[model samples]
Target: MKKLSLLILITVLTFSCGNKKSKSESEPENITQVNPAENYSGTASITQGIATTITEDIYTCDRGRKTDVGEISSTDGKTWIVPAKTHYLNNDFPFATDLHNSCEGLNYDTAEEALANFNAANTITIDNDGETYTAYIFADNYFEMYVNGEPVGKDKVPFTQFNSSVVKFKVKKPFTIAMKLVDWEEHLGVGCEENRGKSFHAGDGGLVAVIKDAQNNIVSSTNDTWKAQTFYTAPIEDLSCVSEEGNYRYSKNCSTEGGQDGANFYALHWETPTDWMATDFDDSNWPNATTFTNKTIGVDNKPAYTNFTSIFDDPEQDAKFIWSTNVILDNEVLLRYTVE
Candidate 1:
């Protein structure tokens, strides 16, 4: 009877041990960290995924493809187009030559009124006590000017009815002049403006400046001597036609010849360096500014430029309309020059 009792005790203990082992295996010690009511069968790593918010900024256009309107991206520029408040004249800088056509709903301060209402004290100062110089500028659409790495002034008009400006600034000689020139877009990244009953017509970009010293002697002008780099190029039916050997963003291999097929065309973009306007920024690798003729840029009909031919189109020390290799296709260009 004692032997039987020993066998029964052993069976009971063995069963108990088996049950305990099974119970321990079924529920892990780490399971207590999970919510009691939750049924998580597996462990998977979690993450905050990339943002998918839709944006039309040409600078960020690489993340999203252009969407269709009449052609792709017609509604895109509204996000990039500065508000009407951008229309106000920078007081010290008046229009040497301004708007030729009436841009409805926008108030234009004429050259006469701006010159008469000019404010001397508020002009931007790179060197407050330095020599005063005048910059005569004409851009196809827009420009932001920098003198020796300081913000001197920007185009009163961001994008629109063509205008030219004269900026008076106090800066020392050997100053680096940097400009961001944008060709206004009807389509954002694709760089096309609607015309000729086609929704995707490509537009051109040009910028010219003549800087004169306080003595009224021309010190510098936009020409092939300037360093130019293109950050935005577009209306490309095929991208293989474009390439960059160093800073030479070549789009010349492609045809700027097509008109209507830009509906689904592609655009190329690059992030502009933050210190691009700084005096010490190294641009020795940048390509020479490609010069464009008045006829090539189609400036004959635009009085803002034509009206000031003596300055911009001067026969003696002419400031060439400079852009990237393909003005018709390159939309946003950065130019740099040093007046030593």
Candidate 2:
């Protein structure tokens, strides 16, 4: 079924995501930065970035959701994985996390370490003529970023643990930023994970970002202005609860009362367009991103987020956490915006 499919021309970036490895070393500087585009060695086919369709009948929370990769871990294994009990990454996710397995991104031992790594002395040469800017970002699970059709970098950890990042990149004005956002799943294509007390609990996702120039002037941030489209949705109790008007995909009416069982629940998946990450991709007709609050995203306690409020939650920046209409049910989402 070509459900909610929209075809349009978009112009860059390599879409073969999930290529970056998790960090196991302490020195991120010594760790090589991998270009996600290089991971795709296949020909430029229509299905290059496409997602496979999933089939299952709509089910209630108690019935359990359908999944192919079953039980990555038991219900007890499903918990919010944070590295420390208190504040970490007090400055920002300045580099790829060395812990690799921990949900935390990058951490600095002291203020000097963080400043030395992220301050003005630091430089990224992606585009020679481009100015340097720090992209402070927080996401529920994972995100891969592209600037002007080139690789910026992907989250070191792709799934399960909540993580954040501050990518230092150089890009000229009028550049396009494309990000592939995945909420990550322990239940695989079903989009549910074991967490809290439920084995088949449905997890939510949110992405917030703020960009600043050398002088710390706000350049861009996540908001309703950006275009967002959901690629995967699950734990749906009723298909009738979902609807679409033009580009606005709606699943807010679906039930989120995840019961212990989700093995027989339904999910929806769609193929991504080949050039959806291109700089010229026409997203004018796409629905505007839906914004959520810190409480709504449940980021009130995560130090990965609370530690960076100076930038991400700055009143001057006024950046907002964003996601597809239904943050709880939507798993994979694509976001885009051009910085003019």
Which residue ranges in model 1 land beyond 4 Å of their true spot? 1-117, 258-263
lDDT for position 134 in model 2: 74
lDDT of 1 by residue, 189-270 (tens): 4667677677667777899888888787889988999999887676676656776675677888776654654445656555
**Number of backbone-clashing residue pairs for each candidate, in the order shown:** 0, 12
lDDT of each: 0.65, 0.63
Model 1 pairs whose backbones collide: none
- Residue 232 alpha-carbon offset, candidate 2, angstroms: 0.5
Instruction: List TM-scores for all candidates, in order.
Output: 0.68, 0.68
Tens-digit per-residue lDDT, 1-340, candidate 2: 2332322211111233344455653336655774322332312111111123342221112233222222122122231111101111223323332212233335543322454555543445667888887787777766777787666656655554455666778878988888878776655545667778887678888999888887878999999999898876777655556666766677788888776766555555555677878888888877789999898999787666776677777776679999888899887788999989
